[model samples]
Target: MFLPPRWLQKDSFPEATTFLAAELSDQFLKLLQEVGPQSNEAILVPASQSLALRSQLRTELSRPDDFSPLVLEGMLMTTVAQAGRSLSRRHHGKPPAWLSRAKELLQDFAGAPPSIEEIAHSAGVHPAHLSREFRRQFGCTPGEYGRQIRIQQAKLHLTKTRWPLSQISLQSGFSDQAHFSRTFKRYTGSTPLEYRRSFTSQ
Candidate 1:
């Protein structure tokens, strides 16, 4: 069972038996407000989505102290936003054409992401306007999304290969190993070495 904050009192689930609970910090709540729907009722999550959430929850629980509170907060915010998107899609059909186009632009250029100005030029929009609209559509800036892709690639290399951290860092497009480690830990809540160890130890 999961519950929204006390302020979102319109939601209720009396029949739920198993609970995965967390205290929503102000930052998490703010993120929800930004990306989530303005709904009062509970949303039905599909079994596949629920299973994925359960896996992530278990991973977090297994090493509770390994993550910062901010990283945990981000995880919850992302989960809630995903559920909100599902609800929105069920009600409003698919996303808009412009959003789809923007997503395509982002994905196509993610490996070597263009600057916001360059992206704006490609989209025939002003940089400030593009920045605001992109965040509203995708919940993060284009640069942040590109960094996420790079970090994900780094994680794959860390798990699947015996390459040195410096090599992985360069391949992932970071300036150096230290920058890569800092950014990775900031987003993922674990250092690169620790992430690799978890895989190897298993």
Candidate 2:
């Protein structure tokens, strides 16, 4: 499961740990350094985004076509650059325990999520502090994270069931099919129908 280079092969992975690494060019490394926090500590990518990127890398690596390598590089570099922004030195270290509660509130919702103020009230933190820490620790605003969860839900529905877009939209917390399609396309770069078609065509 290890790739080339003595450094990359030196360490054994922990049990059940799914490790992923990409060798970056000097240009990309420089960009990452510039965009990333000025600290020497490791940058933390949020678990959900990390899992999504891992899945993408796995799929691209498994591809039997000529374009996989090029696509893989773009995907990895984009992930790195995007993750670098919120991982500042001040945001490092353990997040507050209540932050987990806040995340739970967002994730547990099946419809429109509660407002930021409500989430903060429920988590016993001030709205402003919750907003700041949520971005720092999770790499997204609470609202954005809620939207991401809904998108994940929508994708699951799209690939797993033959549900209509309107039904999936409501079930996934969108106001309507138009809103769902717009948000899904904004996040995924494809319409819901196109995304479903991809799975079918494959």
Candidate 3:
């Protein structure tokens, strides 16, 4: 485990919990809940904390005698990785074979992902086979689809909600208010306040 920098704990640790069990990814983050990813200015803890974590882990893992540092480090890394994969699976929450049929069925799917077995049944194939083909077709796992859906939902909330940023974030499936703010600014090039202002006062 990495030790956070003093700055990360400065005043109050705001963005720390959002990443408690999360993975850093390029397109999206697999947060514990249905929380969306954050953007620039979102990570308040500073890069120092991350650097410290790595350095600490590295230093500790360097010890061999009486430490079993290698084994412990390996386990820790593996666990973090597995958690990410698991969260991705859950976020995808899709059954590949059923997706097309679901598309036909749900109609308003709005690009949401289908479950694994669902995709298999819809494709008239087995789950394993369906997973391969679906990845080939989409350039990403079903998890990407769910991210798109959630991102779109966030967009809608930014456009529609008159509530507080945190409330809008929760209602729209983000991990927290700062996460929503960062993502909203990145995706739309505007803060939630600015985006909402664009709408009519209806």
lDDT at 187, model 3? 49
Q: What is the lDDT of residue 150 in candidate 2?
A: 94
> For residues 6-86, what per-residue lDDT tens digits would candidate 3 score against the true structure?
224333221222233333333232341234212211232212234445466566656656766455555444444443344
Write the residue-wise lDDT of candidate 2 on 4-73 in tens digits. Answer: 2233245432123455667878777666666665434345565557668878888887774798878888
Clashing pairs in 1: 1-18, 1-19
Q: Which ten residues in a row have the lowest lDDT in candidate 3?
A: 37-46
TM for every model, in the order presented, reads: 0.55, 0.62, 0.36
Best by lDDT: 2
In lDDT terms, how accurate is model 1?
0.68
Whichever of 2 and 3 has more TM-score, that candidate is 2
TM-score-based ranking, best first? Answer: 2, 1, 3
Q: Candidate 2: which stretches are off by over 4 Å?
A: 1-82, 85-91
Q: What's the lDDT for candidate 3?
A: 0.50
Q: Which lDDT values do the candidates have, in the order given?
A: 0.68, 0.77, 0.50
